[model samples]
Target: MVVGSDGFWRLLYPIHHAETIRQAAEKNNLDPLLIASIIRVESKFRAENVSKVGAVGLMQLMPETADWIAKESDIPYRGTVDLSDPETNIHMGSWYITSLIKQFKGNRAAAIAAYNAGPGRVSRWINEGVWDGTFETSEKIPVGETRHYIQRVFFSYEKYQQLYPNF
Candidate 1:
């Protein structure tokens, strides 16, 4: 298959947090590649990236979500700036993703789509029953930006799988 361009994943991921995220994902029995993909999709791998929607840091964690993650993971975090650290964000973010997996019954694709769009929206789609799992696999995502993001993360997942198949 003649691949297109390298894709929208050119931004630099923090080398420091790579190890941390790997460890956290391993501990959670989650795929570090998927976590990496989430970071890429969530914040384009910037440690201090902040979204206009009030999501902050590498994981693009919203304030409420960050607090929930902190509580659920029992991680010590004070202000929102702590999330600006790539390591902390990835730590919590990967755990949160794993939690969502449990919530969604290992449906990583649906959980990812919900993370990008929102549980309610995804739930609506799911209840509509017109969407099979393929609808969650990037190409069929409803929202335009989320559609691109889902595709990008899956592409990143493919790259990470090739790079670290054992993980």
Candidate 2:
């Protein structure tokens, strides 16, 4: 029998490092599915992944951003080396997500967009009434990459929640 589409998708989107993801998510009071989705979108579960722009590790954290997160969150951070470690990356990423969520006043879309485009730009768009900080009107976002990033992260987040409810 052919697997249903949901089952097929689940097979494709298996969660990795689930316990680490769960721990980081719980520490930050975030949904584990969200952290898993971000890791999927950012690094495709590749712990050593690094973006062209130098975002390091599974969370694709920029070195400068990671440094700031470490300082603000009081997490042990030595250098870019720390970002390559899956556990440290997850901890820092989760902390950054929580910080962004609070900064964006609990708007997950805005927070996710900020994660991709930087909070300053996202804040400007929101303050200028260019975007309402919701996925439904994402077109108003000036940066195409960030708009798409928000959509991708949200889509992955939904899929993870469906495929791994107990995660």
Candidate 3:
């Protein structure tokens, strides 16, 4: 799926839940495209998809993480099964991403890395200078999975902007 209008549509079709994504982005003070990119990369807008590691829904949030976010944000507690709901998942995931962006001091690459790996590991890497928390230095990230995840998300993010220039 490269090089044509078909590829563009394939890449962006997952963002059909634009209303939910925009609502979550507005509530969290985030760019809707960023949330869309994350959803595209994480679950491809497949609400029923679950990662082998147990992330769920359009945003691919883990149950434990969703629980913590609910408690911390004072959102009502729903069972993990609700993570398969696109609305709930997007809201939770947007809040989590907003928090990560703040935790990483607005370094989006580091926040994306944290989303793939974990905030604690990303923090340690930053604090210890193991990685500089920039896309240019992404190769310095030790975890191969996280490294590629960051790259893929950013690549899709750029495409989302290009395809939807007015978005």
Rank by TM-score (best first): 2, 3, 1
Candidate 1: give the clashing pairs: none
- TM for every model, in the order presented, reads 0.83, 0.95, 0.92
* lDDT (Cα, tens digit) per residue for candidate 2, span 1-167: 25778778877787888899889988999998998888888989999998889999999999999989977987888999989999999999999999999999999999999999999999999899999999999988899999888888989988887888776
Say which prediction, candidate 1 or candidate 3, comes out ahead on TM-score.
3
lDDT of 2: 0.90
lDDT of 1: 0.74
lDDT of each: 0.74, 0.90, 0.88
By lDDT, rank the candidates, best first. 2, 3, 1
Off by over 4 Å in 1: 1-16, 135-138
Better of 1 and 2 by lDDT: 2
Candidate with top TM-score is 2
